[model samples]
Target: MTTTLFSAFWTYTLITALTPGPNNILALSTVTSHGLRQSSRVLAGMSLGFLIIMLLCAGIAFSLATLDPALIHILSWAGAAYILWLALRIATSPPTDAAVQSRPVSFWASFGLQFVNVKIMLYGITALSTFVLPHTRELVWVVGISVLLAAIGSLGNLCWALAGHLFQRLFRRYGRELNIILALLLVYCAVRIFY
Candidate 1:
């Protein structure tokens, strides 16, 4: 790849990874409503999810003649539903150390989520097809880009989660209110994905 193309690829990765999508938004909300320690799991999950999705998208791009429209449709709906469920959970979640206990998002759940994470899936396909695939068919570059993007995205998620922790100071005064707002934002993101 040309130097300019490589720089553009990284630029795209940085912007999308840092953008407040399902992974970032949910992770931020988790840390805010819960705590950084508790939210770490979600951030880990997002990284894993992104990695898996990138690999899968690369595979499909390499092997398939065309990306299946039906699959994209199914993924869109499924992802939206999952995000909606997460929104509900976040909205109704208890304050830290309250009467009720809610389990943090598990690693497996987070890892599996990439299968339907349309944004990351599309990003992966677009990256591989536009930037990497045309340059060479070598698996090394594809895997390298995928792994690198995942690492960068992990940092992005970490920063967002940390921002949530930073907001914990104000949370004591308005936890539920903040949760509702974040939850609503999640719902907005979910709905926006389809429209």
Candidate 2:
């Protein structure tokens, strides 16, 4: 039972963390521009944001299991629309110069962004309501799974960031190409949310 539970937990965490989302996009941008050291702050902020969202979702799940399914569907559609907006922003934004630097995004900005991060919110609610066991143990398992998911997600982001850091020179030379790729990825994610 323990082994099966652990396996299921990690599998869910891996899938949720690895999916393209605003947090991953931000992490990619931060690491590409700022490198890992500075980007670590963004990762920390993102992790905290996930923790907050997960806890809230777990609480809501426990207390309001009886919430109107129609309401959940409404929130889900709203979240999907918001993700499309974000994707449009990413697709249209100008790429930053890798050589000439700007300050990294503030912790508060990163933290607050998660509230509107549709992917993370959906993942949190889904994982809490589906994968983790026992309604009575919802909070505990939700928090534990959240922490694990955050750590794993951060690691995935770190890997992407490191890739961006290592290829910074290439990005500088081919900024337009990189932006197009990122834009496509975001758009794909946005579409996925709906379908």
Candidate 3:
């Protein structure tokens, strides 16, 4: 890739990773409700899941060139529906109080979430196709780039988790309102999938 294209790719990757997508939002919510210690498991799971997705994207990038458009549409619908369900759950969740006995989000739960997260799937695929594939067709290079992108995304998740930890007191005070807003943002994400 040319220097300009390389710069553009990194810019896009960073912006997308840092943005409030399902993974980052969930990391923030988990840390806010539970503490950083408990939430670390979810964050780790999300990172692992993201790495696997990126690896898959690396392999699938070539096949996707000839893949049917309908398959992508079907996946999008499923992802949006799952995201909407998550939004409903978040919207109805109770406040984060010591008296409340809500179960912390499990590693498996967060791991499973990545499978349905459309944003990161597209993020990986787009990065691979638009930036990496044009420059090289070698498997090693493709996988390496995907892994790097996944690391960037994982770092972004950590940033969100830390933000939640730092603002835990404030979040606890307005937990309900913040949850509602997060749910609304999730709803917007789901809606955006269609358009």
How far residue 23's Cα lies from its native spot in candidate 3, in Å, is: 0.8
lDDT of 1 by residue, 32-138 (tens): 76688876777777787788777777789888857879888898899888888877877887755561256677777766766667778777888788888888888
Model 3, runs deviating above 4 Å: 98-100
Q: Which candidate order results from sorting by TM-score in descending order?
A: 3, 1, 2
lDDT assessment of candidate 1: 0.77
Q: Rank the candidates by lDDT, best first.
A: 3, 1, 2
Candidate 2 local distance difference test against the native: 0.68
Clash number for candidate 2 = 0
lDDT (tens digit, per residue) of candidate 2 on 78-138: 6666656655655554566632376676788678767766677666677666666454364
Winner on lDDT between 1 and 3 is 3
Question: lDDT tens string, model 3, 11-43?
Answer: 999999999888888888888888788888899
Candidate 1 displacement at residue 32 in angstroms: 1.9
Candidate 3 displacement at residue 24 in angstroms: 1.1
Residue-level lDDT for 57 in candidate 1? 79
Q: Each model's TM-score, in the order given?
A: 0.88, 0.79, 0.95
